[model samples]
Target: MQNVSSQQHFILNGFAELGDLRPVLFVPFLLMFIVALLANSLLVYVVVSQRSLHQPMSILIAGMACVDLCLPVFFVPNMLLSFLFDWKGISLIGCLVQMHFIHFFGAFQSTFLVWMALDRYFAICTPLHYQELMALQRFLKFIVPLVVRNMLLISLFVSLAGKLSFCRNVMNHCFCEHMALVELACGSTAINNLVGLLTVFLIPVFDFLFIAASYILIISTMLRSSSTSVKALHTCITHAMVITVSLAVALIALLSYRIKNELPAAVRVFFSTMYLLFPSCFNPIIYGVRTTEIRQHMLTTLTHWKRLADPEALDQDGLSVLRSGKSSAKALHTCFTHIIVMVISLTFVLTAFLSYRMNSLPNAGRLFVSIMYMFLPSCINPIIYGVRTTEIRQSILKVLFTYW
Candidate 1:
């Protein structure tokens, strides 16, 4: 027999445990992929387009958004297509590629977290020297090591992994990863394990220590400089939230990978899938909500969208009795009743049609889609409160027209 089992292609049996539900799984996963891609893409465009948003903090955010955007584009769409068609086969070289990027992007995110912390520290603790300390040339020089070091570390890990022989040609999860591939080895995995530990220590562990130290110094400076304490805390709290959420997910992912074989297959699949999706999905949202500049850009962009969506949504609304600074029971009765009846009729007819269209889908699938329609306040709070009478619409149009 050819000894190709250890040298040839492998299979990625993504959520096959779901059986019929596997088809249903495609929608949510794809939806998450699309949303994360668009959200982060728009975030990057907003940061780069809006000139006033160009700052150290905004640049770091845009960098992170770029990472978040690329992270998903590399993995999710392929997984979705694979699941939808049940093509689990992955060539050996393809597996190597996937494994390399998964770790590379992860390490990039950790390095970025540390960079953001340093930016925060300089901004809050050493405000006067911040500009000199963070000059663009100096900052880019500093980042060279961060980018090169991680690439080399993950590259060494992937090269070391390529030495292993794999008799098992099937991955029992949704994605390709170092540890998952390591366990399929036909030879001693001692070297693989050592390299894995080294990679972990060099990337996550080292960056985490620096992150801890940065925060400790930030807090101490905040306390010692009592007058700026409240303002600094207010500014730093959002970064803190983003850091905590990111590290928590990373920790959980590490734990899950370690015990993946021990966990039930379904649990393993879900954790594997979600570990990739969650960071890509949430980081842009956190930054968009928490960062002042990003919030303003998003608000202005959405206001333009609203104006385009409904020209009369502003001062020229047809429903003028409510805006005339005078309201009577008769005006209310006439307008409110007609509008309510028409809306109810449209909503009923459309909902019934939608329900019929979705009748072939399972209850769980239908419920999932329905729940997603329930809008969250965190997603829209900026638009609701950031109304302005400035000529933002024209500016937006000009920028778009110029860029396009």
Candidate 2:
């Protein structure tokens, strides 16, 4: 209640600077957010259900994937809601709540990357001892505390900032961040700034160095071998790739807090958003696809969906040819085009009939929906042929790429 009674609520200028263009940008951003959620969820499902993926490596990947899933839920939904109706008012308590979870999950993800890198290091360096060292029980013991410690430490900075009265309340970022609030304070912000920088160095900065060390040791160990297997080398390379992106994007975001004033507002916003968004979207795509076991399971699932979509597909194994017609996959795709055209024609006819008989709509509006159907090729054929097998069009999508 102290916050509500004293601290002022801030305006989250989330794309409001776009003026009229805010509405136009809403749909694409919403679509991207939804895709990230679904992709992460699918990763979790594949890891949990596939027995072959129960190893320590898959377990850690799934843990990171679960965090990536929750990280977006904290910010994206609110941003979507704000975009839809131009809501920028966030209560002091509300902003603090948002800031806490963002830091908590963001730090946890970086911490997980460090562990995953170490997992590879041990597996390669001490193959005999790796099993005892990275057993699932001992592994959880190492990670759970890291997450809890980070959450409590970040909470301290937010608590201190909450006490200082805010003379300014307009936060320019789409979401509430520690630095954004620190800059808005009325009193001394030296401690807040110091804590923020030190926290960045302590968490992601430390994680990056640890990851680099592990990989350096792994690479050095690999180079000493007489015959370094291609598969083992490939796995190490992919680990480096994930760690590089996760740290680089995170550093850009953390460093931007200090230099945010120098950059354009949009660029600052992009950097801040990408810090979490890239990890949420990229981890599932890279780790999920590169794991051979996960890739095979995903392919099997895709093949099943293909069969379900076309029950008449010639051979279930290959979908090689359609029935007796010797139709290739290209021909099967053409068949889907015909089905879509027919369904759309059916919808227009129903709408026209209902609107015409009711006669409630104005004359001009009715003509477009009702009168236009009579002139189209789809209506002409179905009405004349009346569902005969011999009357289907050879190519129902002739006008797909044309202006018509």
Candidate 3:
């Protein structure tokens, strides 16, 4: 009886330990993940489906979109399962796989963003050579190796990380992160941590330095041009906004992990946002604000979509509300209304589903959060830039008219 009771007690304690904080972690992450998937997917559509956006800059944007797209896919599903099913962790082999893809995609994101900055800097600042320098073939060549390099770099870290043995099953964060897990290992992790640090920081350092140098050259060149180049400045401003947001997040994540020992939980959480959230949320907005073509197309698409859904409605102009060119205010109002409707619809459905699964809500919510976070960019991005950008709208319009 004593032996049996002791074994039972040990099992119960293990269950209790895993249950402490994981259940409550679901909803927030789910909401964010959903937003990311929606946004990034829209970005991909706009970049690939619309021919006008086929420039080198947009091509690089497409690459970033691809990375963002893959990120949530890998992260959200695994995270959701772990959180919801009381399966709060990954096996050693499972963790190696997760880390490999996550780091590869993350590195790819950073590299692509830097590539975009260089593309813009050259186009805006070195106009004379821009065409010859980043020709289609060259752009293709430039990207292939960059992608391969990022994958290899990440692979190196993942292999090194895999070699380290974990004596403790405690993972503080939701995912199979490189440094966080390595820190928990009972084995000597100094080499692993050092390699992880280099993998995260060194490339970013080089990318940042290159971006900064490119911008400086761009600024110097722009200043020397005529006042008529105001449009160019506006373009730079948009690019700068995105570059700043992305670089800032990357820098913080790198710095935070480097000082992971010194930082608080809140700080780590903030760094996590840099990785999983900021890129999806802000990238579209930046493109919408700066790229007139994309913005116009998005607005046009939204208007048309609204009209198509409510074909019976007519505006004051006695025009089919769908086909009528809307004033800026009406367009803005429609956009807001669309967003509210979407949020409410999702909330309603999710709420009902959660209520039905009350006992498993926390784990479900956590899983949902992870999936949603990855999925977030996919859907929202379409509304923000795809529906708003006129050029994309026209392209779609052309296709519709031609085919239908």
Give the best candidate by lDDT.
2
Tell me the lDDT of model 1 at 339: 43
- For model 2 the local lDDT of residue 187 reads 55
lDDT of 3 by residue, 382-404 (tens): 64454445566446445644565
Arranged by lDDT with the best first, the candidates are 2, 1, 3
lDDT of 1 by residue, 1-404 (tens): 22555657888876665666677778878878887898788889899999998888888888988988988876787788777887778888888898899888878877888888888888878899999888988788768988998999899879987877888877777778777787778868877777777777677778878877888888778766656655455455555555654565565555555543344445455555666676677677656545556765665665566567885766544335333322322343334334423432443344334544635334543454355334322332222222111144234334544565
Q: Model 2 — which ten-residue stretch has the worst lDDT?
A: 388-397
How far residue 208's Cα lies from its native spot in candidate 3, in Å, is 1.3
> Candidate 1, clashing residue pairs?
6-166
Clashes of 2: 0
Give RMSD to native, each candidate.
12.3, 16.3, 11.8
The segments of candidate 2 whose C-alpha lies over 4 angstroms from its true place after superposition are 1-5, 226-229, 259-261, 305-404
Superposed Cα deviation of residue 244, candidate 3 (Å): 3.6
TM-score of each model, paired residue for residue: 0.73, 0.73, 0.69
Q: Of 1 and 3, which scores higher on TM-score? A: 1
